[model samples]
Each structure stands twice: as C-alpha cells, then as structure tokens.
Target: MNLIDKYITEVGKHLPRRNRADIEAEIRSTLEDMLEERKQSPSDDAAVIELLKEYGAPRKVAESYVGPRYLIGPRMYPLFEMVIRIVAAVLFGVMLLVFGLGLIGANLSGPEFLKTLGNSALSLLNGLIVAFGNIVLVFAILERVLPAKDFEKELEDWDPKELASEPEPDSEAIGGPGEQIVGTFFLILVLIVLNVYPEWLGVGFFDEGKWVIIAPLLSEAFFSYMPWINILIVLQIGFGIYLLRQGAWNMASRIANILLELASIALMVVMLLGPSLVDMTPEKLAGTPLADVADFFSKGANLLPWLVLGVVIIISTIEAAQGVYRLFKSSPRSPYPVIK
Candidate 1:
C-alpha cells in the first residue's frame, strides 16, 4: 500500500466508527492535494512518501481527536470526582444554615431564649456559608485538571470498586500539602465551633450561679475554680490552630478528646471524694493563708460546687469520647484519610 493509505488506516483505528471513514477520507484528500501542489512532474512518489513521513503515522494523528485533553486526566481518578461533588453539596447546605442564623441574630429582639435562639441560628447559618465556600474552592481547582468528556463517562459508570482499585494515591491526590493544610484548617474550625465552644459546655445550676439550689454566700468561692475549666478550652483552641498550621487535625482531635476524657474521669473521682475531704472553717483558716476569708463562708457549701464541677467533667468526657470515635471512625469514602 502507499504511504498515504497506510497512514489513513492507522489513524482510523482510533476513531469512532461513524467518523472513522470520513476522517480517513479527509486526511487522504488533504495529503493528495499537498502532493499535487508539489508535483513538479507527473509522478513524484518519493515526494509523497516524504510528505507522509513528515506528517506522522495515522495513530499519532488520531490521538488528538480521541479524547479531551487535560493537564490532569479524569481517569487519573474516578472516585475523587464523586467525593468532591458530595462534599460540595454538604458544605453549601451548612453555609446556608450559618448565614440564616447570623441574619436572625442581627435583627431579632425577644426574651433570653428567643434572643439566644436567634443568635444561635445566625451562627449556624454563618458556619454553613463558610463551609460552602471552602467546598467550592476545592472543586474549582479540580475542574482545571479534569477532562471534559470524562465527566459524563464518570457519572454513567460510577462504581465503588473502580475507586478502591485506583493506584494508591500520594499526598498530592487531595491537593498537595498546601490544600491539605487548608482542608485541615477548615476541619478544625468546624470541630471547634461545633464541639468545643464554651457557651455550649457552660450550663447547669452552678454555671448560672443558681442561688436557690445552693446559697449566694458560698457561690463565688464554690465556683471560683470553675474558670479553670477554661484550661480545656485553651488547649482545644490551641489544637485548632495547630491543625490549621500543621495539617494534623486527626491527631490533634484525638489528643483533645483524650484530654477532655481524662478531665471527665477526674471530675467523677473528685465528686466521690469532695464530701469526704476536710471542711472549710474560719478556725481552720485562722493560721492559714485564707484566714481573712474564714469568717465569710462554710466548708460544706464550698465543697458543693466541686461536686457540681465533677458532674460537668463527667458529662464532658462522655461527649468527647463519642465525638472522637465518630471523627476517627468515619466511612472509607471520607475525604479525610483515616491514618490508622
């Protein structure tokens, strides 16, 4: 066969059947026309052969038409595309909730509950908005790397096995170290707002200083160390910042959970032991550093607050454990890789 014929046949193998013959004919005609222009004489087989060689083999030419070009191929990963979509929807929904609450808090006026409800709703809406924005940012980046035609093909052939069987992806799969940092930063933020916020943890009779349940005379001393609970708060905030800066949310979260868990267990122990410990009395303080304050308060009432604190600690621990378990044990499809 002639060089031109061979070239056409090779390229045609890669094209769809419907377009194969048409594309082959077009290429053949174009090459012949070029040869004719170069025809200084009636028969110039050598020139035609040289032209076909310079043009390239048919298969190489056909590659240009076979698929949409991408800096990153969609086939490079099938599951990641779906993961991005799901995360995007969830993030959008959360951002809407936060924004709605913020608007309500700004405009509404009412009793404590009504005011609080408005404020909280506004916070939730604002959070949702932030979440949505992050999701969009991630997806926008992925779009540039993906092949256009593969989008539909990916959807049509969605398969779980396809994802798991994908070659073990490196850290770059998520968006490199920088994107992982950003993602971890956002993850910690969501955790702090949802799990570690003080207003949510600071509740109950002791928290509000319910005088009827205890007594006003002993209230301040009874709960003076309550602010020490803020130690846990400080640690958690630090953890959030660490996760943001270092991209270690999974580890930081686990440590934070353990801290709260230990604190909770300590609280329960204190409650069991507080009543049995020595009483607070003026005479007991007479020679002590607190002597000046002895005339002010009784020991039992002072002890009462410790018991209350112990209760808070226990409750906080259980909550922290549950949260930690859920965070660490999410499904395989989770965007965040479970390190363990």
Candidate 2:
C-alpha cells in the first residue's frame, strides 16, 4: 500500500466502528484533492510530507474527539431534560395544593391552620430539595467512579457468588443473657440522657422543647414529670429489653430510627392540633383558672403525641418481630441439650 493509504488505515483504526467508514472516506477524499493540487508542481517527498503534516496527522485529529460518550447527550440533557423538569413540576403542583388546602382550612376553621400549613410547606420544600441534591450527588459520583457502560457489560451475566451461602448467626456474636441485659440498659440510659438534656449530645433540634414536652399536671407534687414521659420511658425500656433478649441489634437500631421519626411527627401534630383543642371562645377559656385551663389543654395536647408515638412504636415492634421470626426460622438448629 502507498504511504497515504497506510496512514489512512492507521487513522481509521482509532475511530469508532459506527463513524470509521465515513470519517475514512472524508480523509481519503481530502488527501486525494491535496495530491491533485500538488501533482502539477511535481513536489518532492519532503514537500509532500510537509503539506500532509500541515493538514495534521490522523491520530491527533481522532484523539481530539475521543472523550466520553453520553447515554443522554449534553444537548439533549439540557433542552430535553425530563426527570428534573417533571420532578420540579410535580413539586410545584404539590405546593399549590397544600397552599389551597391551608387557605380553605384556615378560612373555614381558624388562623392556626395557616401557620401549620405554611410551616409544613416550607419543611416539605426544603426536604425535597435536600433529598434531590443528595441523590444527584450520589449518582454523579457513581457515574464517574464506575461508568455505566462498563458496569452493564460486567454484570450482563450472573456468577456463582449470586448463590453463595450466607453464614449462620453465631451465638457468640450475640452475647449471653447477662451481657444483653447490661448492654440494653446502657443503650436505654444513653437514649434517656439524650432526651433529657439533648443539647449535651450536640444533636440538631435538641433544644427544641417540642422533642419532649414537660407539662405540669394538676397534682405537681404527685408527679415531678409528665405522666406520658414516664409511660414512654417505660415503653422504651421494654422495647430495649425485647431487643436485647432477642439479640437483634439490627431490629433495635430500626426501632430507634422509627422513634426519632415519630418524635418529629409528634412535633408537627402538636403545632397543627394544639390550638384547635383549646377553648378559643375567649370568655370560657379566659375565665377558667389559667392553671386548670393550661393543665387541661396541655394534657389533651399531650395525648396525641403519645398516641402517635404508641402507634409508630407498635408498628416498628411488629416489623422487628417479623424480621426476627424469619431469621430464626431460616437458621438451622443443632441437636444439643439445654440445661433447664
């Protein structure tokens, strides 16, 4: 083959299979035109080579365009962006609905509805933005670290690892009865201390008294703390004990997470429901002993939080119990004697 043809072949090898032929034809046609222009001058090999160099080597031209290939091209991503646009539109619609509902509720009922709705809308918007940002960040990192095309090729077929045996739960990993009791008590103590003086733990929203209310009952001497607080602590302790006895740390952690979620929900419910439960008629509510009125409203408002917390706690407990039952059921038991 001639030098020009050899150079053309080398350059064509570097181009993608889809565009290689078209690119090769274009290069060949251009080179032929250059040769035709120089033929009349009868140029030496060095002059011809210099002319070809001026046109740039095929590899250099190819390398300039050899960066990333996108699943969604930049042009398409910007002008035809589907996911983000759809998400934003949905969120806007949700905001409008929430605002409309808030207006209707407030006009029909009272001003407190407006306050609650506004707070909830702001929170929802903030949470959605934060969540969207995090998800985008995670996906961007994954794309950079592990290209989707390569990942797809690698995982196209399954491997034996897919069916590998899972290890049985070791008795040693789950401590003895005594150790469990001690560990559970320690966890309970930490949870309680964190609740009592939450700022001490450096967690966000700890200072928000909405986390745990300490309402003064009618008989203050009889109860130094709110009656519900005592009930919750007892329930939490019971939950902890159950976790320890079952040796289910996973379940315990989930229960803890659910408790935190319920706490936040309780705060929202209070802000929404507290004002309505009050005797807003002015005369009756104002004339009644302030202490008695405060006590009644506080007690009533307090009930919802506990009730919501109880429902969440119960649901979490049931889920955990089911998980534990499934795990134990799948585990193979050995033929051994237990000391009764």
Candidate 3:
C-alpha cells in the first residue's frame, strides 16, 4: 500500500544518508512480511497502519538505529589517542630540558626560586591546554567531514579472517586524515611561532619582584638557515596535504617523504656541526636577576641546541629508514615487453 511506502520514506528522511537506503529497504521488507503473516491485503490501509504503529514512529525507529555521535569517531580514535600521547611526551621532555637548563649555576633555594618553578608548571599547563584544544578542533572537523561509509562495516558480514590482517589496512587507505591533520596543525603552528614570536622561546624568572628575560636562545646562526628551513617546512606541509588527498602513500609520495627526511637530517647535521645556533649573551643579562648565571646561560644553554639537533637527526634517520622500507615493500614490478 502507498501507506507502507510513505512510512518508509519518512523513516529514510530521518536516517543518515549513507545508511538510509539499506534501512528503508529493511523496514519495508519487514512490514511486507507482517502484512503477509496477518493475511492482510495491500489495499487495506488500516491493517498496514496497525503494523507501522507496532513498528514505532519513524523518528523513534530512526533513533533506535543510531547511537551517540562522536567528535572523533570510532575509526580514527586510536590514531587520535596515539597523537595525544606523542604530543604529551614531547611537551614534558621539552619542559624538563628547559627546567634543567634554567637551574644551571643558580641558587636553588629562595622564594623567587619557587616562583620560577611555579611559573614553569603554569606554563606547561597552558601549553597542554592549547595543544589539546588544537587537536580536538582538527579531529572534530575530520569527524564531520569524512564519509560515513568508511566508518563501519555491517556486523552480519564480519569475518574471523579479518583478524589475520588487523594490523594493516588497505594499501589505499593507509595514513588516513588523522595523521595528516595533526602533523600539519603543529607544523604550521611551529612556522607561525618561529616567524612571528620567536621570543617566546626564552627563559624567564622573577628578579627582585620584576620579571627578567635571558637572551632568547636562537642566534643569528639559526635564523640564517631560515630560507632553507622555510622551504623544507613548507614542502613538508604541502606533502602532508598531498598524502591526505591521496588517502595513502604511493611510490612517488614515499620517495618524496624519504627525500624530505633526508633533507631534514642534513639540516640538523649542519646546524649541529656548524656555528653555534644558541646565543645567550651576557650583556643582555647585565642588570637582570639571572646575571650571575651568564656563564651557565652562554655555555650550558648553548649545548641544548646540539642536543635538540641530535635528537631530531636520529628521529629523521629512523623516519627515512621506514619510508625506504615501505617504498620498496609496496613497489610493483617494472613493465617489460618481449618479442617472439
């Protein structure tokens, strides 16, 4: 009867576009079965009405088919969690490095000393909140933008064999939106901060109830590399977007990533082995509370750049290795022609 068709239409209107067709078909089939079981003709709209009533109203039926929504849906959740852990670890590691350096050649016991510690903790808390907000914002956008078809599979069609390949996804679906979004967000932020407010990367402490700043650690030696650094970072940003659009890594993109990592390693090596990148000149600290620690700042703080570069070099080498391995692993046989 037209009543059954109308009822299914109404239900379909309420369901997600991806699931609407299948659900509407299922509901229609069930209603038809009920009509047959009750020996009711399609012409008898009253009997069909009774069947739909028992099935529940369209809105209620739609609600039953769906559950709660998520800001970062189930499929991408593992990736989101992983990025959070990495970000937290990096932030804490940086805080520890800065705190240790600031403590160099200074009296560790005083009211101002405690204030310094409190300020560092508050700064760390603020950093975590900002990072979390950025992550959530990107993930929420991804959750709404990604297609629903990719989120889940039909439960009835699941196979035990899926466990055999649980660690790997389809070659085309590798390195999904989560990785791209998080990486690009942070990298862009780094570029902005370095270019716009590089002074934020300094040490500060209270000196006789007035705030004092040590010379910012970045030196002319480091800024000189900005052109090359800009090229690499901008290329990296573009490469990440390409991978997001491609939905997976291909041989060309894999090669591109490898080259980029190699370039990063080379830059870190040059910065590490070349002229000093950190300069905490004593002149700037002449009248500050931290004046006595000038030797510690100029010498000890200078070592931090080397430590950072070394760590970056190691990470880039590993990333380059992995990119090489995957590139060959997924490469296809070269095409050849033979003549009879």
Candidate 4:
C-alpha cells in the first residue's frame, strides 16, 4: 500500500471500533481532496509523505476525530485532583509519623541511622506511587461507568435558594473541600495501616549486622476497636466525598460530622476503660540495644494509654463542638425562603 493508505490504516487502528470504518473513509476522502487541491501526485511517494506530514501523526489525527478524550472528564477533574492531593498529603504525613516513632524508639549507630532513613524514604516513595496509582484507577473506572447525563442532572438540580441565608461573622468557618478531602484520606490510610499493614507501624534497628524490627506500638486491645474505627472512617470518607462533589458544606454534612465525632469519642472512651493500648513487651525489646529504654516504656505503658485516651477525647470534643457550631451557623433563617 502507498503511504496515504498506510497512514489511514494506522489512524483507523487508533479509533473506536464502532466508528473506525466511517472515520477512515472520511479521513481518506479529505486527504484525497487536499492532495487534489495541492496538485500533488497521489502515485508519488515523496509527495504523499509530505502531505501526510502536514496532516500530522496518525495518533493525533485519530484523536482529533475522536474529540476530547479524558480518563476523568471535566466534571470529575476537580474531584480527581483533590483526591490525589489528599492521598499524597496523607501518605506523607503517615511516613513522617512512622519515621518519628522509629527515631524515638530505635537506638542506631551513624551508618545504621542513615540506612534506616534511606529505607524509610524508599518506603515512602513506593507508598506514594501505589496510592497515586490506586486513586487514578478508581477515578478512571468511575469515568467509564458513571453516565455523563446523571452528573448533568445533578448540576441541574442545584437551587440558588439553598445558599446560606445569612453570614455569621463570629462563627468559625467549616473546613473547605480540600481540608475535608485530606482529613478523609488521612483517616483511610490510618484504617488500612492499622488493619492490613500493622507491621509498618513498628520501629526497626540494626543488631549485630542484622536488621531487627520491633512489634507494632499499638496493642491487640487497640485493634479490637478497628471495626468501629473502620466504620467511622468510611462515614467520614462518604461525607468528604459528598462535600467534594457539592463543593460546600450544608446542614446534612454538619450533622453527619457531629455524629461521627461523637461515635469516635465513645470508641475512645471504651478503649480507655478496656485495656492497655500500647505493647512494649520484653520479647519485642530483647534483641535491641535499647532494652533499658524499652523497660522504661513498659513501666510507663499505663501512663501512655491514659495520655492517648486524653488526647483523643480532647480532639473529638473539639471537633464535635465545631460541627455543632457550624450547623447552627448554617441553619436556615426565617427571613429567607427555604428551598424545597
């Protein structure tokens, strides 16, 4: 076949099966018309090559025929981007927390310290890659499976009357979509690490030229609350996703937030009264040079549980209070007509 024919075939290969033949025929006809206008000999290979070059690469030409192709379309692009940033931030935060814990717990020589840092860095990089891949894959699947018209309908359903009735100058602003997205993403990572990859939460040390890892800092009693925590995480994730799509918080979201916060507080209270939340057993500390330090931790483990429980209660109380205030601030005013 001649260059033009070969070019058309290549373009056709890149096109969707349903429209390939029709698009190929149209492109070929257009090329012929253009060649006729240029007075280029179709039989001349050089002239055909020059003409094809002006037309552009086969892939580009096919793309033009296909129109704008997106793995995640414009409607979902902002949400997709927000999700990616949140996941990345959460991953970074988790890595930093892990590294800090290791630094505090592990006793290492200069070279061993450097090696540990290097390994932590590599692990963080890999985790980020995997997180990004998963996020992209999810969005891509949503893009394909979700009907465009459904999103359009959602857009159409919006009512201007639902806008905040009055501005509260003294009221604290609720978290924006970005903040909620990041918070939700962070919670998800916590759930996954706590449940699936608890070993990653441990400290590592070099012992007699062999690397040794300690048991995870969290105890089995802490894990007993995982199912409850998972439920909270899932709820928060759903709320965050709703805020992301709506691009604002409303009464519904505020109420959901308050409920989740209360649930978290209850769980923390249960944990505090139940059992020790930290595991610094002698066996976990045996091979390490920091046995004395570990013994101190074990002795002080009771205090550690109380400290953690106090922190959780304080944070959850603050969050719940904020949610209530936000709900009150956003409530519909009598002067403004409520949207049905």
- Candidate 3: where is the Cα deviation over 4 Å? 1-173, 205-212, 330-340
For 219-312, candidate 4 gives per-residue lDDT tens digits of 8888888788888778878877766666555566677778888988888888888978778786688767657687775666647768877997
In terms of TM-score, which candidate is strongest?
A: 4
What is candidate 3's lDDT per residue for 1-340, written digit by digit as tens?
Answer: 3988988888888899998899999988888888999999777988978888899999989888986667887877887887787677667655655565456434688975776677677777888899999998988898888776755655456789987744333244555465566677668877987899787667675466443555687889999998898899999999988776667666678789999999999888888888988777777767776688877766777889878888888888999998788666754443566556
Give model 3's TM-score versus the native structure. Answer: 0.51
lDDT of each: 0.55, 0.53, 0.78, 0.77
Separately for all candidates shown, the number of backbone clashes (residues 3 or more apart, or on different chains) is 13, 0, 0, 0
Model 1 poorest 10 in a row by lDDT: 211-220
In model 3, residue pairs whose N, Cα or C atoms come closer than 3 Å (at least 3 residues apart or on different chains), thus clashing, are: none
Q: Give the CA lDDT, 0 to 100, for residue 145 in model 4.
A: 94
Candidate 1 TM-score to native? 0.29
What would the C-alpha RMSD of candidate 4 be, to one decimal place? Answer: 8.5
Give candidate 4's TM-score: 0.54
Q: Write the number of the candidate with greater TM-score, choosing between 3 and 4.
A: 4
Candidate 4 yields a Cα-based lDDT of: 0.77
